[model samples]
Target: MPQLLMIEDDARLAQMVGEYLEQSGFVLTHATDGKAGLALLEAPTAAGLPDLVLLDLMLPDMDGLEVCRRLRALPSDAARLPVVMLTAKGDPMDRIIGLEMGADDYLPKPFEPRELLARIRAVLRRRGEAAPSARIMRFGSLEIDRDARTVTVAGEAREITSYQFDLLAALAERAGRVLTRDQIMEAVRGRELEAFDRSIDVHMGRIRAAIEADPKNPKRILTVRGVGYVFARQQD
Candidate 1:
């Protein structure tokens, strides 16, 4: 069973979610605040860290975004840990902000348990498929080493979240092909794109910032207007 750490302050909702997830064959550890969640994450226990984190954006102690940023700043494996933010805010910007802060995914409040389960499964599945391979891809000064799960530009390591790395890898693997948002989502997460979903675009911007010398004039990943995006095969 996959272990999950849920950082949510609502006692009753946490109980309900914990029960549902446990019944669905997941082992859940609940933290009522961001501090507690970070503490648990930093502790090196014999059991190791949980497979994923379900972080609540509104926390009693600190903003969930701060927690996420701190988590990514950690000098340990916790930095790259997969996070899915849970928020009650209805604004799409909240979701986009969370994604920009390195969250793998997010679920708005009032979501059905089934949808939550599906999201969890999709995130976990993506992580599972991130195993190292022997293939190495290069374009100009950019290098993607599948065996090490690392990306470098001009011989310098580029800082990117693990999910963003996967997204870039997916696009690079199909270089020169214009892949629709739906196709990119399916390739990365094994799920269809949701209506009005701009998560892919957000991730793409982040990836470009990391790899492109000038993100404003990206040469590797090119946009295809209404179609989607393509990784350029030729480098100038």
Candidate 2:
């Protein structure tokens, strides 16, 4: 069972989402503010960190965006945690800003619990899977050695989990094509499950770190807005 942390100021909404996702088999943790969520995340856990984060952009104490920036600044080995911003603000610019701030995904408030569950599953699936090949995959200065199970950027080796490697291979294999959240989930899993999961964003985040010089402003692995992901570069 993958653990999840839900950070939102609205107690009622938090409880609703927590209960809904819990019913879907995910263990849940809740925080009423971004500061409190940050505290819990920094605290040690016997089994380690939660698999994913559900963050609310509005907070009483501090901006959720700042918290996300600080979290991503942590050492990669600390967890490579993925965050999903849950906001009521519907501005498209806000969504883009959240992505720039390192959020793996964003869900506007009043969204369906099923959509949230799907997003959670998508992120978790990426965390749990492994690369499909051992052969090194290349795209420009990036090199992902599937066999070595490692990635190299500018000839320097990078630390990436098996899931991350797998996500990168999937994108590289079909460079320039837009892969919807469902398409990515299928490619990563190599089969079908429920079509509602959002783990693809999590896996894509890992890939962004491997190849993008500035993941906050990724030039590769670009989001297709309300659809899916696209390998921003053209094929050879």
Scored against the true structure, residue 199 in model 2 reaches a CA lDDT of 67
Q: Evaluated with lDDT, which candidate comes out highest? A: 1
RMSD of candidate 2 to the truth, in angstroms, is: 14.1
- Tens digits of per-residue lDDT, candidate 2, 1-236, equal 46788888899998888888888877778888877887767762333357788899989998788888877876532236788898888899988989998788899988999999988788767655743443766767887776677788889988777767677777766554566676666677854344454666766787788678998888767887787776644222
The best candidate in terms of TM-score: 1
Return the clash pairs for model 1, or none. Answer: none
User: Candidate 2: worst 10 consecutive residues by lDDT?
Assistant: 190-199
**Could you give candidate 1's per-residue lDDT for residues 2-91 as a string of tens digits?**
678899999899889989999998878899999999998887333346778999999999989999999999876678889999999988
The regions of model 1 sitting more than 4 angstroms off are 133-236
